[model samples]
Target chain A: MSRKKGFWRSSVWSLSLLAVLAGCGSNAASDSNGAAGGTATNAAGSDSEKEPVVLKLTTWNPISQTVVDKFQEKYPYITIEHDKVYDQFREIIRTRIVSKSDMDMLWLFPNQVAEFSKEDVLMDITGSPWLDNYLEAAVKLGTVDGKTYGVPYNSQPIVMFYNKTLFGELGLEIPQTWDELLAVSEQIKGSGTAPMVIGSKDGWATQFITTAQFGLYQHDNPDVFAQVASGEKKWTDPEFSTYFDGMKELADKGYLLENSVGLSYDQVAQVFKEGKAAMWPMGEWGYSENFDADFSAFELGAFPIPVNRGDQPLVTSLVSDNLLVGVSWSKHQEEIKLFMEFVADPEIAKIWSDETKQAVTVKGGTSETYSPLASSLQPLVDASEAQIFPSMTSSIEPVMFPIFQQILLKQDVDTSKLLEQLQAAQNKDI
Target chain B: MKFMNFRNYIMFILPALLIYLLFFAGPIFSGLYYGFTDWNGFSFKADWVGLENFREAFRDPLLLTALKNMLILSVVVIVLQHSFSILLAVLLDQKLKGIVWMRAVIFFPVILNTVVIGYVWSYMYAPMVGFLPKFFDAIGLHGLAALDWLGDPSLAIYAIALVMVWQYTGYSMMIYLAGLQSVSGEIYEAASIDGAGPWNKFWRVTLPLLIPSVIVNTVLSVIGCMKMFEHVFIMTQGGPANSTQTFGIMIYQYAFKTSQMGYGTAMAMILSVMILAVTYVQIKLLSRMEVAN
Candidate 1:
């Protein structure tokens, strides 16, 4: 009886061990399959026996996905994957570029393109026949040291976005000059309607409005300002005070909302939506979401930011937010350029522009169908003489951004203090 | 039988040791090495930068601001969280109806994700739309109270700390409650028999016994607050000027945002050192109090 019991016990233990091994084997296979499945599902253009050419595009905007989807329908053999990452996409792409990883087609702004070109990371696209298609100013923005590094896909001119209802209630006219704009703001403020709302909370939003005011003068003499930045001219020149003091004077006069220092642009936009503010300085795309009936209460209009000392109105715009097809380290250069040319075709451009409600850079597309807000912004686009402004981030020399933020926040920061700080920052090396 | 004993020991300890080696010790050692190189985090190649990254960290203005904010936040959250928690635990220790339900309600915030808690509090602090400020306005206390809780530089850090206190006070309270229950009722009974008042019994008997609990709670609070990152990032992104920026945000921006990977890693190393030093000081002080008690 004892022998039989021991034999049964040994058999039971062996069976359990076999079961455990089987379980472990299956689990390991399942985990491997899970990781493989993720890659397989995301693999582009693997629809049939033929593997399609895959192109990857990265942007912080989700709208890029819509553009990619439209492009993919026309070229079923080519798959476009748009990677949307907020706040971290630029860093990730920069690291990949520096590391020589497979990065194809990035939506880099003009300033960023300039900085990257300086670092020898961007491809020179100047000789491409596609250069004839874009507006000259748009083309110029993408060029650094006379070499084209990217394609201009979209333009967002910093126009004066005003509330028609508030303007009418306050019995005010659209300001045509810097002094007129300030006078109207004062009048509107007297009527207890917030004359202007610029959200300084994000700090960058403040830069947008302040940059536009600076543009009125800067665009007239880009060479002089560019020289100042290059240290050929003093940054403390009185023109610098004229630029900084304009924003300071507005803030000191309480032309902005009481809580302007703390409110975000979204919150400031809400004030306009709620009919609390008379005007907001923003880009053309700011009103894109007003398609919802709830936000249609206010009529939107864009005017060139009132001229300070120039006959022409100049606007600060980044090159349009569009996808640029860069040759990936792994991709065949000829095939990538061919794909980019196909997407830039006028017919395809027409479809994209009509659907997205933004201008397309293709030479022979219809410009008549733009939204009402886009229509008003056309004059600023046509009269836009300047190529690009110094992006506080892209140019590493001066971290002018934080200096700008400090000026906006400290209301009492003296001009001399500002110039000393800017000069010091501007001299710092990357 | 000797071989079987060896196999049993391996079966018991091998998995845990392997996990600890892979997850804990491995990454820390890797991070330390990376701190010395100009590695962009994706490539096989990197340049040796010596102590250049450290030199940059010392010069970064934003890093200094972030360090200051982190230090202030750590001190405020640790002290306030423990004090409120002990008070609540003491109150709940007294026998009362619905005390169990009250305890659960208090503990609810502790179980919540920091991200959710941070966002919900941001809405509550939202100037025009937030209910908190609006409620104050309704009560005719607008001038005295309707400050933009997260927007104003002077007030933003306090707002972040208040949310942290709300979330973790319940956790600290539970620890104190457990410590309270462990103290014998016999001592309290004897004090009552000797005609000692309730306050006198709490001061002489309960307070001394709770010393160990206070030490545990204080140390944990200090460590957790020192490493705070997620809530601050989600709430303000260190905005309105770098007012709410902390050491974690500074390190993350340098590492990821600016592509100064080496510099960022160096900042992170400094932060870890700060946390270690603060924790050591706290433990030393608390241990002294423990010995005295």
Candidate 2:
């Protein structure tokens, strides 16, 4: 019995020691890999050419397989492993960074550039030659503190997708001003059809409405967001509150889809596709081939959300999407740069634009085969200005979504109080 | 022999203890450490902010709203789940045809993945095209049909709580069933001989004896509901104006979404303390009740 007990005790202790050693061994291995990566970054060009490299690209956005195949064909030594993480993308990326995972490239949003760069997770690509090929506004989206960290991929403006068949049936021409929009909405509502679909349940969807208003607001006061950030202006001021009030008016007048707060973004698209509503306020991706909805049931037409300015051509609010950034810790810096140059190529950008149906940020990258629905928005896109909403660039962006949701959900919501909440969130962030 | 047995016992538990210390205890202690700092998650520079995060958390209207919602959900889940579970346990405990199959049917939802259940309930509660609204419309109850189950700010949390009860009541029922099975049949016979009616016997004998099960069920339900995330996250994402937001969702939003890891950790520590304190008081009171009964 003593011998048996001794054996058991020895075995258990040995197993525990093994577990500890295994953990330490893995850590040591990780440390060595990190050291190697750091060295390789300094000695990249020559070392990268001879040694075959596999780059790990992580993105929440869908990348075209054809684009990947073309890139691989051009650079045979470089193998790209694309990992798509849709749900909890930011959280997962943060975890990967903390774990020192070998993520070579990342598809990020423009809003995330400052935050990620501040964390020192992004590689500075300010001096990259291919950056000159992008539009000035596109390049500016990924630049923080006068240093570029990401390559802007697409310029997707939030536009209104109206059922052309329904619009024709209702005798509603595209509204050019806010008042005109309200009048058209009222007419559509009077005909027993919901005027618009806003998926307030998915809180982020509410940004489309709010950002459109901000887009118009920024046209006149370009430094409005900067003033708000610096405490020169308050969110509760009429300058900001009026836009929210505009949003509330649409809800108050029963113009938006009933029970829209119950619908997801995809569900609202489905609602629009089913002809349940006259207009769907969403990003340009809604009409793209990548969109889940089948719009064959109705003639789809899109227009920029009408600003208050009547005669002046509408300045569409263009938001940069799929901003590709190199992970700072990646071993294959040369390979990542090569991929960046490939994406920046106008021909490759055109292929990407054609496949994804987004307006690529590369100069001369717009696809010629745009459908009439996509083609209609070209004038607005040409006159578009990228406006950074103060809330989106700040830490208060998450809270802004809920505030927008509250405005849409509650008919009698106090816009001043909601804006006060925004001010408070901003103060806390500061 | 006693010394040898003690050594052997320590050895047996050594591996598990090492793992527990390494993973669970280590992370918790590290989390507590981080709670005192202003760590923005990705940055290695974490300046110590003392109790600032916790102090701000108290003033945070969103955190207060989340706490209120969590408490309401906990109470609703506990009451509804326990009542349904006790009733079902009693009903199914009786010797009847297909009682085993009936128990299995009741327990089926408990076995289903929470994500699957959340999605299923979401579809069922979805507006305009959902089963509940369509069913109500078909039955000539247009008013109920028009009611947005998961949308209306006043109704969303309760709607989620209903799903919680539906999924977890069976789990609680099994516990009560086990307690029922353990109760000797002779005790009921004695009660009957003493001229006790069904309700009298249940009140004086069955329920009091089932105190252990009640304690177990209540504690589990309270903790489970306090940590409610997957259901609310999957269904409404604490949306339609932050109505269904709980501590769990708020913690996640702060930690990951807003990049306030230190503040999120502080919130988490507060939640853990709250859970521990609540559970402690509950066990104390319930254990006293058990002893008295």
Candidate 3:
């Protein structure tokens, strides 16, 4: 009887041990699967090519289902699982990347591309044939250390969208220089309308005026930020402080919308739509079909934010938007490549541009259909000597938002001190 | 026989023990280890930098601002939330018409998700188009209507604290109500017979009996407010010049946004210690009061 009881006890212990081992084994397998570039079922010896693959593409920006459908229709073997993360996108993406999650592709911001490239979380797509179709400058945005990690899908130029009806009523013409812009703003303020509406409460919106000015600055000092990084120049120098001076002048003179610091981006958009402000400084993407439907009551016109004091030609900031990058750990590299190539096609780019109302980066990808405002902005987009604004780069971008917010919010803000702070932040990062 | 029982007990609890060690204890230990290293979120390698992150955190002005904001939020929430909950509990404990519905109505917000509450309050606190502003405008208080509740740095944290109080007062009230109900009728009757007025009876009898509930509520509120993230994140995103940034949001910004996971983890470890110390003192003081009662 004792021997039989001991045998039963040993059997129970063996089964429990096996159970625990199985649990641990499964976890290890799943973890290794991500690092080893294999799917869960691939461990079972199935041919990966014959198996239908679902590639997970995560983005924070809006994407069209039509584009996804078209991509899927062309490649029947691959399915794109579009995951949209609305809030805390960068944080989520960072966590996902760190964990070696099964993310096939991602839409990265320029700074994110720069930061992620340093960690080798993104695939180097240098010398890809499809990249030849994009504008060289746009393609250069995703390149760091002479290797491309992302492909720019759209070019967003920060332009001033003026209330045409309001300008007409006030007999104001498009400002061609900084002095003329200030005069127009003063006149608009005199006419009992807010000169400009900026959603400074959302820190990112504070970049519009500064970025526009920096574009003109960069036109002269193309290597200004690089110099700052190398300790040859300071952010407090007139080259950078001049931009803040212009932005501060607008705030100090009461030319901005009342309580502009309190208004959110969406609220400011609505205020501009209601003709409460004379000009709304935003990216060209703001002139979408939804904006058209809501803002149909009044006509709108676009102009580059004039940043020159004299006869210096106008230049506006062009930022690369909707950058598609391949995850380094993705098992479906070929499928991700195919998808990227498909997007690089001019026809596909045109469809995306039309759907998003943003300019595509692909050569010959200009949409045939354009709104009147977009049409008016196209010449500026085409002819303006635009560059990625200095503050938009990865090293200096983080401090820009808070410093710009301080400029807008604090009446007696020490511009020199704020610039010093920016320099200090850049120094720390370096 | 005892050894056999012991073996059976170990066999039964081994699975649970392994799970707890793996999931709960494992992360905490790893986090503690990471706190001493310089682990950017992207890189797998973490170099040891003993006491450096903590030293830097002390000098970080933004961390100081976040700490200040967190303390102010905690004090405001603890005082106001407890006072209002105790008041509501006392009132609802009285014999009143439709009291059940009133209790349910009051408790409804407690059941709602924090994110839902945050978004709803964001709409309510929005400047022009929000319900509060419109209501104030309708009541002819245009000045109040024009106040930017979430955007103004001075007012944003307080506004979020108010939302926290609104969502959680009902939960605290429920606990107080339970404490109130557990008290025998004879105690109140005896106080009444001793010629004690309503105020005296509440102070001497009801309030003393509610000491346990107050302790529970205070500890929970302190911990919850210390870790406040959702409302501030969803509403202002610590904006308008980092006015509403809390310690939790600061950690998140460093850990994920800036890729300084080690520094963020160090700050989190400091916050955890602070919370533990504060909670310990609170419980000790409250428990003494309970013992006195």
Query: What TM-score, to 2 decimals, does candidate 3 have?
Result: 0.92
Q: Candidate 2 - CAPRI tier?
A: medium
Q: Rate the local accuracy (lDDT) of all candidates.
A: 0.67, 0.81, 0.80
Shares of reference contacts reproduced by the candidates, in order, are 0.21, 0.63, 0.42
CAPRI-style docking class of model 3 based on DockQ? acceptable
The digit string of per-residue lDDT tens for model 1 on B1-293 reads 68667655655565565556656887788888889998754444678888888887788777767767777877788788878888899899989999999999999998888888877786677666667877888898986355877777788888888888889999999999999999999999999999989789878888789988988887788777667788787777677567788877777766665455676788888889988898798889888987887
Model-by-model DockQ, in order: 0.29, 0.58, 0.48
Query: Tens digits of per-residue lDDT for model 2 on A125-175?
Result: 998999999987677768778899986687777788888888898788988
Write model 2 residue lDDT over B1-293, tens digit each, in one string. 89879877877787778778877888899999999999988776899999999998998878877888889988898888899999999999999999999999999999999999988888788788679988999999999999888889899999999999999988999999999999999999999999999999889998999999999999988898888899999998888788888999989888888778999999999999999999999999999999998
Cα RMSDs, all models: 6.9, 3.3, 3.7
Q: What is the Å distance of residue B150 in model 2 from its true position? A: 1.2
In model 3, the Cα lDDT at residue A20 comes to 81
Candidate 3 residue runs with Cα over 4 Å from true position: A1-51, A226-233, A289-294, A370-372, A389-398
Every candidate's chain B TM-score = 0.93, 0.96, 0.97
Q: Write the per-residue lDDT of candidate 3 for residues A1-430, one digit (tens) a residue.
A: 6845975786687667657854753442354436445543333343444578798889877776778899988776678998999887877887777666668888888778877788877877999999999988778778888999987777777889898888899898988888999999999999998999887666777788877876676677776765676678777777676758888888888888876576677777877887888898887766663375555768888888887787687887876766899987677677778789999999888888777667778888868574556677777666767776432444365577877777777557787888887887777555
Displacement of residue A19 (Cα, Å) in model 1 is: 28
Residue A13 CA displacement from its true place in model 1, Å: 25
